[model samples]
Target: MSVRQLLYLAPIAAVLLASSSVVNGQDGVAEELVVLTDLAGLGRDENSVTYFKASNAGAYERFGESIALSADGTTLAVGAIFEDSSATGVGGDQADFSAPNAGAVYIFTRTGSNWSQQAYIKASNTGASDRFGLSVALSHDGDTLAVGALGEDSAATGINGDQHDNSIDNAGAAYIFTRENRTWSQQAYIKASNTGRIEEGDQFGYDVVLNGNGDTLAVSAISEDSAATGVGGEQDDDSAAEIGAVYVYSRDGADWSQQAYLKPRSFSTEMLIGGILFGFAIGMDESGNTLAISGFNEETNRGSIYVFERAGSDWFEQARLVASNPEIGDGLGSAIAVSADGNTIAAGAFDEDSALVGIVPSDQGIDDQRTDDAIGAAYVFVRRGDTWSQQAFIKPTNTQVNQHFGWTLALSLDGDTLAVGAHFENGGSTGINGDQRDTSAQDAGAAYVYSRSGTTWTPRAYVKASNTFARAEFGSSLALNDDGTVLAVGAPREADGAAGINGNQAADSAAESGAVYIY
Candidate 1:
């Protein structure tokens, strides 16, 4: 039942070996593929594996659903939004279950080759169905952490405000935690500043990101229903239903303040009638001066990404990017990432149908394939001074329909390296460089690495979990260290009995418990 697969790219001498299972690429071709074994069978040469689960986690706890890594690769934050922990705050008892779905986050520290749990975090005002830790982000130094609770029903706003208020349903909120020495404490609480009377269903903290220095934070409310155009606009406007909004906050010394409220400038009666989830995805540069916001349902689901730049204390819209050959239902901005320096950006179109491989010309028409749906693609954009240009079109070598290749993305500090996740990829082969041709493993998922030289990008590696199983969703979430040397892939639906580092992955041992792998 276990096999080691080896794939060799002859020209590069880069050998990819899998543990439990082996899948070979095309025969006689320079690209000789190798598939490795399962997580329990990985060799010493393979990356060390660490499995994480809540101490009292149940079958549907989903411990590794969201993951964030420090720039130095020494610290990690994992989110378990479905964790039914009744305990509130840090280091509380984990067995209490009075509050169902209150959610929890786990912090881990790595020393040498061993990783250990450092802290268990929960909302200061933990309540039933709050769903804290739905999304997590760590500062470059790993000292500051941001946790989002998209299902939180609080009606509070601003920093450290009242969290007990639940007059609004699913209004959402985010928390900021700071670590000094090795102890962590709640630093601030954030909510939409412009949330007027009808604040229900805003889902303010659906996604969050922090700048490298942790001085700036960006949060998205994908269900924000305001027609506001810019900073401090009329937030009470309900004309735009689910148009979405992004909020930017800046820290001064120890205090954080709402800096700007961002919305697309194309907002109009027609747009308000058509816009949907404009801020579904967001990314910010290290300086916190540049930002990318995606409206995946814009233009009849063709999707668009908006770029914004900061000047003094104001943020202004810089550019609105769309696929050169825009097609309906392409979902071009479903996922996005920006480099540390704000010079590079990547946008994913998970529903793209083009079969073209590697870099495609920006002028290429959308007529490449009409039948191949959801083949997926990612586009890289480079900034020269104030002008931005599309630099590359990237795809996996084994691109196939419905793989959702760009469902998630992570970029290195320099933006020269990128990791793309295809959470719906169907390949029975497990581990790295496995046979991507097989479709037996439904939703097993895969990740791809690409390196950039000048303006060209080359495929570097194909990654997957050692214990591939149907619906494990190995590449559902991804995070890279500062230099892209360390990558963490999350399989939130993994059904393994494994609890902690290198445990047994017995078939059907645990269902939907989730797992995380470091490579």
Candidate 2:
């Protein structure tokens, strides 16, 4: 008896099919992995020069930033953050640092394939240096938008706007805008209670995600009050600071309020020990009740992931996951993505150690040291009974070391499909051929797709944009739409063109700009 092998295809369309189907023992089915990128079809303008195609489409550049999508996937609700000329315009000097950042939100309705700018929302009280539209997130239904203003001082926290001021007094804030009667309006402004203090500059409300109902919200403050719960601290002045945390807020009728403060469960001797609970990223469920948060720096050069559950309407810490293999240097959970039901979780560990390929002879063309260094990997966990356990631990079957397994992770709502990125993989480009030690292509990156069959999991495809330029680092960031039909990966260092798009050409050095790939 022989075991059938699974066939994996190019990651650009990670489609997989078994040599023989287990269900029928003789049938073969096609699998798919799609790639998308903004660099492909975009109109360049002074304000929105660099357009990105997220699930809905995203545009951000020097002058202004806008993100909008229609509820039906046909229309878009856009928001732009730019300087208000009335308060602060692009002064005569292009290098002038005195200009302020204030912007507005808009709602655009699209019909067929045609989209026209619908409404322009100017901040209610535009001011200098107020970058109102710093970040934006839409609900599953695309009816609600959450925007962050990390520079806003409306709550008058002690932290002055002085760029040189070292005081931790600025508590960042967020605004909720809803669409009613085809018009969008401000719904709520989120700020931690007692908004002003030296602890405030923790940059709260930097990133946000909303459930379908837009009632429950999760906000991340990479730097909040370390003394407060759910916040992480740091040691002295090494600059690897850890004042991080996240807050969960709930909405009742029209009133939105903070419901819980989430932090990692740790056994630390000192409150300032900085061992655990440095919140950096967060995602929530449809009701905003269930939450997932990432502490990219839980341990020196390592990270952890935390999950919280809401009982009825009360939110509480539920589970904490450090990589099952607790190697001191592997920073598991550096970035995370959670499903709408909170039942599925995907985590990226960009610095995971690997030994996938050991040694193969020269003429054979199988390179030794292929899986060396801290190549990334991703882990998946699913909820069962009252406990959650690892459902799958996936890395590309042919991964090389230093590929950075978990550069980014994404799981669909049903938990059936998963995507893992290895931003440093040598995808058959270098003449060195499949050797993990072959940095010939240098920092070239790649992504992998996997699917589950009952309790078993298999690699379905390996993908990289066909035009992916060499050393492009494409897997640094990834986002997957709920059904897993669309994926967006950021290779910020890639150049802008077809031939040298991904890692086609060696980088000028290691320092390069970034780009987002959509699939």
Candidate 3:
């Protein structure tokens, strides 16, 4: 067992061992929940294989080829990508031989000790290179699946009965597959009004997310026109490559149509500032109306997150987010996690000021110094009626400069609970109490949990994987299940800790694997 697995399983084991019920003769351990150590294998795949052990100590069953967990956790949907052998006239000469990847999706259900596949749905005319199943999202009930085929020939005509022909370029398309009477059907196929380009890494339709009722779907085009074109034309920011965007779609009953296109008003300016540009859709909310788009490499390498809201039936730009008091050179807001309600948001400023704490005062009196870039922090936001305001700024209780890269943030609904990952902290530095962050051998990964009580929030628990080390892996990604009871922290390149002992090994000398923490 690895340290990652032990951290998660130990709690459940302790709880079970205290009870006197014999559990399947497997150490009489009545498993409340079994936390899997590894979520993905080595390879650049974004989707994870879904698994579940229905009963305590039951066999682990692979639930689907590709699974997306719904926000409610009651249902899960599986998706697959299928290639269409014949797709001619749709996209000829312009379609490069090396440029198409297609895909499809499957749905599943969990009841008692049985996990079964529920539905199989595919995009029409899916073919090799379409990469359809590349991105998939499930509604809260698992009845709807949104799949993206960014490689589809956008120039084809009469889609969803519209006479408009698809545009050339990397015109991407998204399909909404709905389940009714236990039968699944393709409800609609959506394409951008202007999809003409052959950018290899355009990565169109890279991410897809759905609202609770499946009434809303947000699709991202990292390579889409950045100018926010109401009138069609390629608009360049002059500062960045491939301006990113999120499109919102709404469904009434069973009919769906494009409703809004969202991009930051001065997003072009934000990208062009430092001559280095970065943009992509890393995460989104349930409604798809609310999106969390990330951009770094901008001025000072400090990143920013943009939140878009759907007003009634139309999606529009809601607010722009950066470090509340952005540090001049601190690269904050690089990684983000937004709750389904959009009311709560967490942005990671992995490079914010940490060393100035001793020099600066408390939250009661704001710090005035403009140049403090040692430690990192995460910003939390709460939405008021029409706009959003900063609610709290968070840092590890014991944080140090260059060590606590408070790099990832995860917020639970109601914004009451938060989980932070500081991949670089060495125990014994500041409030961090492990030898992991030591110069010669930073030993392990640590995560902090905070809870909001009344108006003030307090750090409730600090967790560390026993055998972790410096550079074992950057604890860069984090996810919190709806209730915040289950926290999945990704240490993508972690090493296998002591055998049976499940703790730390010698620093810098271990194999790489990823660990997921369940609290």
Model 1 — TM-score against the truth? Answer: 0.90
* Alpha-carbon deviation at 260 in model 3, angstroms: 1.6
Model 2 lDDT, residue 163, Cα: 25
Name the top lDDT candidate.
Answer: 1
Instruction: Write candidate 2's Cα lDDT for 291-402 as tens digits.
Output: 8887665665456777877877666678887666545456666557676677777776666664432111111211212222675556677777658886655555554656
- Each model's lDDT: 0.75, 0.49, 0.48
- TM-scores for every candidate against the unseen true structure: 0.90, 0.66, 0.61
Task: Kindly report which residue stretches of model 2 are placed more than 4 angstroms away from their true locations once superposed.
Answer: 1-135, 149-170, 181-183, 194-200, 228-243, 265-267, 275-277, 357-372, 397-403, 422-445, 466-473, 491-517
**Candidate whose TM-score is highest:** 1
Report the C-alpha displacement of residue 404, candidate 1, in angstroms: 1.0
* Per-residue lDDT of model 3, residues 277-327, tens digit only: 222334566655577666544455566777665556655556667665665
Candidate 1, residues 1-519: lDDT per residue as tens digits?
000010000000001112221122221112433333332222323344555555555677777667888998778888877788788889998888788878888888878767788899999888888778777888999999998887787778888788888888778888999999999988888888865344457878878899999999999888788888866677878778778899999999879899998888767565688765777778889888999998878877788889999988899999888887778777788778899999999988878887665455666535575554787888898889989888887766676778777877888899987888887788787656656667798887777777777886766667777677788877777787877767777777788866655666655677877777776
List runs of model 3 lying over 4 Å from the truth.
Answer: 1-68, 74-136, 145-191, 229-240, 253-255, 267-270, 273-292, 295-298, 353-375, 397-407, 422-446, 463-476, 491-519
